[model samples]
Target: MEVVIGLLAVLVLFFAAGYFIRKNIYREVDRLEARKIEIMNRSLADEMARVKELKMTGQAEELFEKWRQEWDEIITSQLPEVEELLFDAEDHADKYRFKKSKEVLKHIERMLDAAEQNIEQIIEEIYELVTSEERNSSEIEEVREKFKKAKKTLLAHSHTFGNAHAKLETALYEVYEALKLFESETESGNYLAAREILTKQTAVLEQLCAQIEVIPALLSDCQTVIPNQLSEIKDGYEEMASQGYFLGHIQIQSETERISGSLSLFQEKISLLETEGIHESLQEIHESIETMYDLLEKEVHAHHYVLAETLKTESALQELHAEKLISKEETDAVKLSYHLSEEETSRLRHIDKQISSLQKRYTHIQDKMANEKIAYSLLKDELIELEKQMSDVKAEHAEYREMLHALRKEELTAREQLSEARTLLSEAARLVSKSNIPGLPAVYTELLSDAKRSVSQVSEKLNELPLDMVAVNVLLEDAVSASAKVREQTEDMIEQVYYVEKIIQYGNRFRSRDENLSRELSEAEKLFRHYEYESSLKKAATAIETVEPGSFEKIGSLVEEDLEELKNK
Candidate 1:
């Protein structure tokens, strides 16, 4: 009886377990299908938004068709197959085949997963297809408005517009035609093609508008402003010429004729409403007028400059001429000693020639003023030009005279330098003699020889005919340099010899304390005997320092005192 009751309890537990298992399996299937339906709904909404935004319904239709195929497969194949399998699994579970039911549920889950993946991928592909086709509606309208503005400018300035702007007219007509074509294309959903056409047309229309707007200004300038400027330039030329400006270099007649020709051509072009290169020609004409005015103003300035400079030049030339008449003899003798350079010689000849020519011109002008009633207006420039030449000649003469003065000054300087150099040479030799001769380097002898040779060379330069004072000065510098070297070497040798003697004398004190000190002192003495005062001083000082540590400095101070006393003596 206990065994029977236990079996009944086991059957009730098994039935409850089966019922719970079947319910969980159905719930899992429902959950997977709900997830797929949710994804499909969200993806469809996304596709719809993409289609509306991009106006790319072609790809949206393809995606929707593929989705429909997938969905139909899911409903017909996956759903029904899974449902039939679930029934078989249910039958197996009813017969206690829970394993088969689980396997069937797994199969349903896999199909649902694959279907969800395919739907997600299809959604992405449709999204990719339509993503970049973002449409802007006003692109063509913007270009059309630009064309209209350009056309408005053309119509408003139709009368003043250059008749030869047929290209502009053709462009306008083309714009109009293209606008119609754009409208048609736009209504037909060809926005991209219409946008491209509108972009190119807008650029063309903008360029045409720019050209059209400048037409009236160009016409008015060429017709009135530049012509008035030409008149002003002509009057300026005549006015300046009346003021005695030498307009000889300025081809007034030819330029006036050229201006007339340009004006006539411009009038003909204006009559024809010519446009090609018209603005360039207008600017060229304007520049020509300005250039003419510039040239006329320059002439006016030159005329005034000549008038003012003429009086200055005449007065200066007269003063210089008088001075030259007086100083001629004085300068001639001064000039005889001068060694002029090539440039100076040529300048002198030029000055003389210019002075003679100017005087001749002055005399001729004075004669013309006396007899032919020559206007001072004309003679002013010519006479001023001659006077200018004379003034330059006088200035050139002054430069040449200054050059002569420089040479004489150089000669005097050379003499003074030579004397100074001789004194240095004597002092250098005396100083060397006072030093220990055997202790001197051979280089000192060579330096003394160089000094003597330099002094002799400078003295010879002083005796030369042209007296190349510059050469004498150069030799004096060399002598001073050489003498200075001899002086330095001799002085340095004397100082070292004295220092060596003091060090050696001081080193003797330490020689009794150390055998090496005695040996070092002997070696220093041998070097001193050989006239190597610098090395001897070093060795002796080192030897002394080895014994007394600061003995060399004390010795140097004592030797300096002794040398100072000798100098006082």
Candidate 2:
């Protein structure tokens, strides 16, 4: 019984599996049928109707027939094959042949794809033909209008185009012929051919319009403007030549002839409509003419400059000559009193030589100007250089004059300083004599003697023939320093002596009470008698300060007051 039940369950499962397999195969068959119907429904017919609306002959008619035939083949042969495959797939699924049904469905899907591609290709070809026809019809009208306008402009401005008018007319004729060909091809239904012709003619018309626009100005420059300028330049050249203005470097005649030849050649090229390099050639000719004009104008300007600057330069030369003479006289006068260095004398001689050389240059320029053959531009440059040299010479002359003045000032300063030093030494001597400090130390005496000698040396130097002020100033500085030292030392020594005396006398009061004070005061007296006042003052002040606490400072103040009073007296 268990075996039968297992066999029954097994049969149930086999039927259930077959049912599911059949259902899936039916689903696939339905999907492929739907794809085939969609492929059949593409709008290729409407696009074909568009193609038929155009002029259908020649290439257009032939393309239209080919596309229509391809569409017919897809609808009749390809789609029916897909429908047959769909039916076969449905039959296989109904009989429980799932594998065979899948194979048939796959075949139907492939057929549908091929038919869809064929329909798309036919529709695309028809659309392309229709669009080309429409574009050719519209664009040809525009191209014709452009050609008409361009030809009209060329006719209106034939004079402005100069000799290029004939060649330009020929180019317009070619464009007109191309327009005719486009119309002929369009009428014959070869729109693609018409489009090619229209494209080429449109470019030609645009180029011709541009050429017409600029040719007038360029021709006017070449024919009238440049020739008039050349004529004016030649006339100016003749006028200036007669007026004694040297204008030979310009080569005006040959250059004008060459430019005339170029203008003629340019006219020929323009007649043939070969305007590629003519614009640049005309520009070069204009620049050449401008350069000639500039050269002539420079001569005119330079002639006026030469006339005015020549007189100014001559006056400056005369002034410089007078200054040089004055410098020589002053140098001679100073030579008798002050010794001048060799470099100083040589500098004056160098100035003289420079002035002499400049004078020669001035003469040469005058001679050149008198001949009226040399270009004034060259003369102007020479005169400018001469004026600059004169300016430099004037600067040197001013500097040398200041140097001579400084020499005299320095000599006078040295003498004044010497006199002041002598007076300072005398004051120092008078201070020593009045101080009554028993005698000065040996070093102080030697310094005083040296101060006197320094003063004497400065005076002797000042008195020497061709007085070397350099040496005199040096001696004067030494005398000033020596005299100041003597005066400072004399005052310091005299104050020290007074301080020592006052301190010793003031310490005597403490001597009776402090034996050490008495002994130190005796030693201080000995130092004072020996002119060792500074040492004596320190010894005495130390003893008194030890006994009286602040006696040294009190005595120093009193001594300072007494010395101030004496100096005033």
Q: What does each candidate score in C-alpha RMSD?
A: 15.5, 6.4
Compared with the true structure, model 2 gives a TM-score of 0.80
TM-scores for all candidates: the values are 0.44, 0.80
lDDT of 1 by residue, 1-569 (tens): 99999999999998899899877776765675566556444435556555455443344455556666775676567656655665665676666777887787788678767877876776766555443233325455566676778777767777665553555678789888977876665554454555566667767777666666776687677567876876777787777666545566667678767867876676566545455686777677667667777766665555466456656755666786676554465445655664445675566556656666776777676676465344344666676577656757777788767776787888888778778777776765665555544655566667778888987887887787655555667777887787677767766777788888788776776677789999998998898888787888888887788788987777778878866664454
- Give the Å error, residue 207, model 1: 41
* Residue 402, candidate 2: alpha-carbon lDDT: 92
> How would you encode candidate 2's per-residue C-alpha lDDT over 488-530 as one tens digit per residue?
9989999989988898888888788889999999999999999
lDDT of each: 0.68, 0.86
User: What is the RMSD of candidate 2?
Assistant: 6.4
Candidate 1 regions with alpha-carbon error over 4 angstroms: 1-338, 371-375, 433-439
